[model samples]
Target chain A: MDVKTRKITGQVIFVLLALYLDGLMKWAFLNNMNTGEVMLIPQLMLMVLVMLSMRISDRRQLITYGIVFGLIYDSYYFGMIGLYTVLLPLAMVGVDHYKFLFVKANMGYEISIYFLALTFMQSGIYILERLLQQTKVDTMDFITFTLGPTLLWNMIVFFILYIPLANLSDWLVKYRRDK
Target chain B: MQKFFSNKKLIILMLIIIVTFGLLAVSVNIKDKKSTPPVIQQVGNDTVSIVGGIFAYPTNAVKNASSEFSDLYNTYTENRRLKSKIGELAQNQAKLKVVQEENKKLKDELKLNATLTDYTFVNASVLSRSPSSWQSYLTINRGQTSGLKKNMPVMSGKGLIGRIIEVNKISSKVELISTDNELNDKFASEIQSDNKNVTGIVSKYDSDSGDLVMENVTSTKDVKKGQKVITSGLGGLTPRGLYIGKVSAIKKDNYGMTNSVYITPAAELRNFTVVTVIKSSVSGEE
Candidate 1:
């Protein structure tokens, strides 16, 4: 009911929207089922989470968002648990831990952070899936086809969406300090 | 020893790794071995799917509209070609209806309840496709509540696409045929050639060429390019006579010991929103 709760609710909604968009964007456009070997996985949810974690100083809240959304993501999309469930929270916590290094969040700092997080989350998933025998793609092919394209595409998307997303997350997190 | 163990960050990192592998291993085992996921996971998936429908509907609409616009581009040529077949198609349909009636009567006389070809279907709109590479699954709206079960062969408008891998309370995941997963994507298929039908397992997906590779073929001698391939219904949950694709090419394996038949899948594997899950009237061994 208070301004703080409402702001937190807005942040959650923002992340939720990103979560759903990740799947929808893939379904609607990035679905290259037949011809292409290069795959581009939209990580808008990770982007949003990274942006929010940069601004939202509360480590507990960041981890909570990570675990809850990660669970939902794993259960809903991947059908197996732990890929997103573990990596999402860990990536957020990693962001939160090193966030003090940057004095102010800007396009450059946020984009680089997202790049690192995306690489970590994706490589973590690749390793886990490979170990489980869920996928047989070798490390070279994975880096060349899946990781490279996904990073390039997501970075471009981050560039195009950086202004709106960064502003929105900034507003969502800054209101508590204003009060 | 106590100081090293007491380092809080180190302890947390170890805990994270342990939990990560633990959850991943257990869930992967459950996915492979269990018919259904745990009850809590089912409830969580169903709830998320219900909310996802709101977003999915609009996206599906846009997809359909765009595909339709593309269809419009080729409507003229398609219509001209299809017009020539209209008369033959009508005759075939009438003959098919009569034959179906006579076949039903014969089955009734023989006291046969259901055959491999006897199947009913439930239609469900696709909610979303997993963005992951290895587990390329599409979450559909219908699930156990809609008389759906695991391993049901799902079809898009044209032909066979994939099979249901996971079913929740009201949503299910269909593993696409294009997935490179070594397990859980095989379909028993047969190519209809001039002399005899050659049976094979539609196994691996060739991502480079975008063709499905059918391995362990009985004999590829009679197989030729452009012949229709259908589910032979020899084993597994799928019923017989479901159209899979056409025989694209037959090539010998690397060692040249056996042959593998490549098929051009009939389903577009894209642009379609709704999928039909076929429920065979005759149940197979569980």
Candidate 2:
């Protein structure tokens, strides 16, 4: 195939890897079933999606990726439909909208954007689940136990994985720049 | 109308919000009300799970190897403790064999076909556990194709772990017993004592201390710590004599109106990668 098609395929595979890694990481390491109140949800897929959105300039492409992958994510992992299906596209669009403010996608800007996106998506989920009566956790307990630990853990992971992920996403989007 | 139609971004934003809540509400209801999800969803889940098994198997292997290393660390003490019980276990096995034979003969004479304790199991390796906080579900490889059904009790190496909440064509989801959800976590259980059995619903999970809280108990007077707890089979779907846990402590609710028996679950909940889905021989009311 052509270079552009190959590059797009690489991007999809990269995001898919991140998606699987989210569930596997939770199952392997963060499986705190019995002992602790603190919960850490791995959002590696969001991290990859944000990185790709910053690089790929097309708005429609971003939304499409968001919806398709989000549907798969929700169906396979969450066993529910709309949480990721809606929030993911919104988060991607939000990233794409603000991306032009930065001249170059550096670590600082990308990490901050990811942090914002993660916060928005997670809080959106909590609010929606609360409204649906799916979860009864009060606001204070959710903030302290689930949200706090999740942010800290994911931030550390983003920091550790920043260099490779940034370089990979840059390579995946470089074909458009060459054209 | 013209002014409102001119703002495309606003229209899209409103559409997204409306669709979001609409999809969430409908799917949640379907999940609660339906025995199986829609066929298209089942196909999607089965495809994802099949691919997931490729990744899950290797991770499970690594997990098993690591756990084996830890097991080696405790081998000496475990061996010593187990050695003393070997003789007793052998004698119990012989006695149990004779009793089972006599019981089978008696049942045949009485024309009884199946009992609550009769169950068959399908073993499934867990593919992944949901990262969500409230939904503590594990996706397993076996599903409707394996004759698995919803609400069937799941067990690990030690004891009961959870129940099947959703079944797809080739994969299913097991909702763990530790989930605090009000609708799905209840298991009818009874404390086994020498004289009298105290029956109760193993309903709530106390996340603070990681203990299962049993409520609606008939009497706490006969309940005692260190007693065994098992499924009483009073409820439909689950079979009798499935090991639940040991009675850890008894406490009163905040209102102090009733007593709750707390059980320390026998299943490790974190360590195992495979689960057994028990199919009761005598199906209860649908």
Candidate 3:
């Protein structure tokens, strides 16, 4: 394959791996089985998406990644289409829109961006599911139990995986020297 | 009218809102009412699950190894406890087999093909679980091709775990019993107490204490702390005698009018890499 094709392929594979890791991590570790009250959902896919959104300057590509992966995620995992399919694109676009403020991406900015994206995506999902009558968890309970723990856990994971993830995402989005 | 329609962003925003609600409403309706999702969605899910198996297998292998390691740690005590129960277990097994044979003969004499309690199971390996907060679903490898149907109760090695909520071509989603969703978790359950069978619905999950909330019990007076709870088969989709859990505690509603039995679920709800989907022999009101 050509260099551009190779880069795009690498990016797709990385995102796919992240997506799979999200589910595996939940199944293997963060299932909240022992402590049923506090739920910690791994947002590795969202973290990778946020990183890519910041790096990939093309708005249309970011939105496409959002909607497509969102659909796959919703279909395969959530069993609902609209939750991720719409909100993911919105999150990506939001990241892409605000990323211009940062002349150069740094750990601080990337981490905060991921944090915001995670919060927005998760809260959006909660609200939509609530309205759809998919979940009966009250607001306070949701925030304290689900949102609080998920954010903390994912943030810690993001911090730990930041260097490698950021570098990998940078390489995936960077243009070829030959081009 | 032309000028009003010329605002591209406004039109796009309106379209997006309409599409969002429209998609959400339609998908939810289809999931609740239909046996399977749309063809496109089924194909998408099946394809994704096919690829997901590659990652799931290795992870599940590692999970199994870890669980085995933990089991090894407790083997000495567990072996002693198990040895004490072995004689009783063998006796119960022989008695159960004889009773099952008798029940089969009686059913044959009556020409009863199937009943609410008659069920067969298909084992499916764990693929992956949903990472969402509300929709606590587990994707298993088996699907409609394996006679899996929507709302069929699933079990882990220990006991009842959940039910199949969505069935695709070659994959399906099991909504666990512990989910906060009201419509999906209700199971017709009963407790076997001395002299009587008190029936109730396992309708809610208490996440705080990790107990299932069984409501509408005839009498909480007879429900002891250690009484075993099982499915009553009142609901046609689920078969009778599926072990749910033990009665942990009984609590009254705020009004003191009704009682809810808190059950400690039998299934660990984790550490299992495979699940069994119970397909009832008798077709109910579905």
Candidate 4:
């Protein structure tokens, strides 16, 4: 395989790793199971996707990744189509659109951008699920129990893992001339 | 007309909106209908779950080890408490075996192959739990090939935990009893009261208090705290006498209309790696 193809494969593997981690972390650590009212959903895949979108420059590529991963995520995890399948790509494109305004990516900018993206994606999911009558959780209860804790937990995770994750995504997206 | 269609961006945006609603509506309809999802979706889920098992097994191993460590801390006191019950348990086991054999003979004589009380179980390991808030699904390794079907009650070691919501070729999703979804959470349950039974529907889950609300109860007068609740088999797919929980508290709804009995489910709802899916002998109407 050529270097370009190899890099793309590596990027896909990285994203997939993060995707599995989302399920694993929820299964292992954040398992609520008859205990707490606060539901914290770990969005590790979104964190990885945001990092990749910030690095990869192609708009078409971003949308494609979004739709493909979104489909898998919906089919396997949610068991319902169109929630992540639509929202994930929209979030990726949103990040890609405004990301150029920054001269250079840093912890603060990336963190804030991720924060907005997470908020947007989560709220979009909540609204869609609510409208579809899949969930009856009221807005206040949703904001309090589900949204707030999830954001805080995922943001703290993003903050801690930002350096290693950012470097890895950079390595995956960077062009090598030797190939 | 040609000039009106010239805006490519607007057309794309319109298409996206149409597609989004279309997909959501169709999927939601499919879910409500209880039909198998499209072929591509089933294949995709099975493939994903097959790969997911590799990751889930190791994580579940670690989880089991850690929980065992915690169990070790309380073993001494637990052992002392369990020693007293051992004698009673042995007697009960003997009696149960005799009764089971007699019942089987009676059933054969009566030409009854299966009844509401009869069921078989399939064991499956936990693959992954959905990260969504309201869905509350746990993917398991067993699926259609295992004779599993949707709406089968699943249990951990302790008691009933949930029911199968979706099934693929090799993987299925279990929707927990604690799910906030109104349509899928209700269980036809009954409480063993003095000399009689108090039947009700275990409908709502109170997340804040971590109690299951059993409504439509016949009488709260006979009901008491600590009474055992189990499936009544009124709904047919679920077998009778599947342990649900113990009656924790009884309260009146708003305006003091109907009584709702709060139950503390026996299943820990966590910690267990393997789950048993109970397939009832008598198939009911879908």
Candidate 5:
């Protein structure tokens, strides 16, 4: 009914929509479908954008979003449950751990922390899998190809997502004041 | 003294809870059917098309913001072509659906035809590859159930991504042809030339260019550049005709019949959608 609520709803819709796009990109890129591969922004970039837009209230919601993201992946051609359970909470933990220091320092710090956490959450599991003889990767080559850009991509996604979310946050503040 | 007693009691309580929950968790994990690893991480790559039965269906699961930008173009000439020519439209649409069905049928045919060939391709998706120099590994969507075996070869359009060295029910890890720090030495000593069909044990995966070091030739084989290197049918473990790489450069020993050769793949290792898995044919020794 109020502008603040409407703003919050819009933000949620944007994040969800971005997530859906990332899921589609995963399908398009990974599955090699015939879906005309013209990406305005790559999925990882979009992911970072969405993450930047995100300002969840509590840990439970963060976990819920993570599960939803993971399940969307699983239902498709992939089924990596280990990634979701391990990576999602770790992302949240890293974010929470760093949020306090970064928030005071600058948005850049906050963003970097998000990037590092997501990167670690993803590639860390990969590293573990390879090290424990759980994977068949030729350790160095795997490092060269799989870790770096994935980290940067997530960071980019967060960066892009932050812009619109900032405007929405401003609006929410305005509405709260007016009320 | 009283506080110490309470702390001791608390520790005992925590330990009991941990053990109880740990046992429960283990039992639950054991009970779940999905938790088990799928077989065929190596041998069943021939079944990708068969196994792709459900996954190949078309889906409009997620629409994106960019659609609004493109919707205007679709509404005009795109629709007019199909709309004005109704008779042609009907025929073409019917034909198009038929063609699609046919295409899927052909894919199934490939799957069937696959088993007949020594080269069994396990079509798996690239899960992750980053530009970071250190993070080298690709997670594939297909795992054990796909007939992927440990040491089963994987390649993109360019050439060898690696072998399916580790496998779970739904995913597999490929050890790319140019991997460093191999944990196992036994399988490490073999490199089948993509060019000459000469079989030699590996000197090592040269990281500088990401090629293999092939050994065991006399002082007379003409191992030259642009020559194709592939698995030798002699070893009979991996199917032949798999591209190891194009021989980029070579340095002759002068006294012996060996050269330090550089080979490059056809596919960019960091990015690719699909890849084939090469397996030795069940029929054996042609």
Candidate 6:
């Protein structure tokens, strides 16, 4: 498989992955938890995973994967209904637009964006939903108890992940151009 | 250093992303729309309710989609069975709406009012509690931003461990009634009053032991064993008549100060989360 085409296929796999991970656990959350109770606080888990995967490819492709992947993710797990589809595509577009001007963003910038992105995506929609009188937005201990761990965990994963993935992506991009 | 910058296709793609994000930023002026349609002003209002609640449309779509087969038969006859069950459930839901309205009225009439009513009670998790003293403290998950003022009461169940002494939005500490012996004595008198048919001072005694002593005992008062010991409600926290424990003794005191009265606590403090914030109800939005 040529690198470009293989990367395309990987995006499709990403969609399926988002579906399985978000869907089954969502089923559990829905069946067991009560109304107004938050089961899965939005985390950086999938967001970082998708963003990191982009190192292996290009901007157009990143969104192509993210949108396809996001549609499935939103469909399965969230009560917001269409949010993931909306948010994931936007995140991809954000990265594609700024990835170069920002230029890898260093380690701190990357992690900060990653953290800010997840927090804004999760809490932004939640605050909006709460204001609209849809779902109640809980900002109490959630900022610390819940948001802190998710960010910390994602940062740890990113540190472990970025260098290897960046190298791999560089290798693949070079190899594809040579071929 | 940046070899990828020379790629024209990448530059064009970045331009497209930048423009699209700008458009979306403007378009994302999301107002709350319930059951609204998706065309201009029409789009925001058509399906908000359906969108708000339990993604019912999606599940329905799943059922219909499963029955639809491009090649192999995906959904089985069991789908039909489940579909009918879903139909029955929908009918039942309409009936439930009426019952819920009726129940709300009853709660109001019961006058189940608590003392702390003038504050916003943020629902938070119980992180930890003190290990010693009946006047023990608990920690909650909310703090400063949550409007959890200091000395706010922590509560759960029908009057579980409460009495908030410290608070922040992200975390708060609570002084549980179990951690202090002073409140326990006051609570005992209240517990004993609820059941009536028995007499005793507000006191603390062992629950498991069979003997509970009574102060100011007149053999004529006829305080008998095995009588129920409940909250006397004199402490002004929980109301009178709440069950605390059963009386197991009728022994007299030597100094007339009272005997070593043994009384059991009502609740077994272990794994409880999700408490009600008993703030005073504002008059219009019941």
Query: Which scores higher on DockQ, 1 or 4?
Result: 1
RMSD of each: 1.1, 1.2, 1.5, 1.2, 12.8, 18.9
Please give the C-alpha DockQ score of model 5.
0.08
Candidate 2 chain B: worst 10 consecutive residues by lDDT? B128-137
Candidate achieving the largest lDDT: 1
What would the per-residue lDDT of candidate 6 be over residues B118-198, giving only the tens digit for each residue? 224457654333211111344455554565544334455544344444433244455444331332223324223333444
For DockQ, the strongest prediction is 1
Q: Taking the tens digit of each residue's C-alpha lDDT, what string does model 3 give over A39-143?
A: 899999999999998888889888889899989998889877898999999999999888889999999999999888889988998888889898777999989
Question: Residue A11, candidate 4: how far off, in angstroms?
Answer: 0.7
The sequence of per-residue lDDT tens digits that candidate 1 reaches over residues B161-181 is 999999998999999999998
lDDT of each: 0.93, 0.92, 0.90, 0.91, 0.49, 0.44
Tell me each candidate's i-RMS in Å. Answer: 0.7, 0.8, 1.2, 1.0, 11.3, 17.3
Candidate 5 Cα misplacement greater than 4 A, ranges: A1-54, A63-84, A97-109, A115-157, A165-179, B1-151, B155-161, B165-175, B178-197, B202-207, B215-222, B234-237, B250-260, B266-274, B283-286
Candidate ranking (lDDT, best to worst): 1, 2, 4, 3, 5, 6
Displacement of the residue B85 alpha carbon in candidate 5, Å: 43
Please give, for residues A59-102, the per-residue lDDT of candidate 2 as tens digits: 99999999999999989887889999999999999999888899
Better of 2 and 6 by TM-score: 2
Model 2 spans > 4 angstroms off: A176-179
DockQ of each: 0.91, 0.80, 0.77, 0.81, 0.08, 0.07
What TM-score, computed on C-alpha atoms, does each candidate reach? 0.98, 0.98, 0.96, 0.98, 0.49, 0.35
Listing candidates in order, what is each one's chain A TM-score?
A: 0.97, 0.97, 0.96, 0.97, 0.62, 0.66
Model 6 TM-score is: 0.35
lDDT of 1 at B281: 88
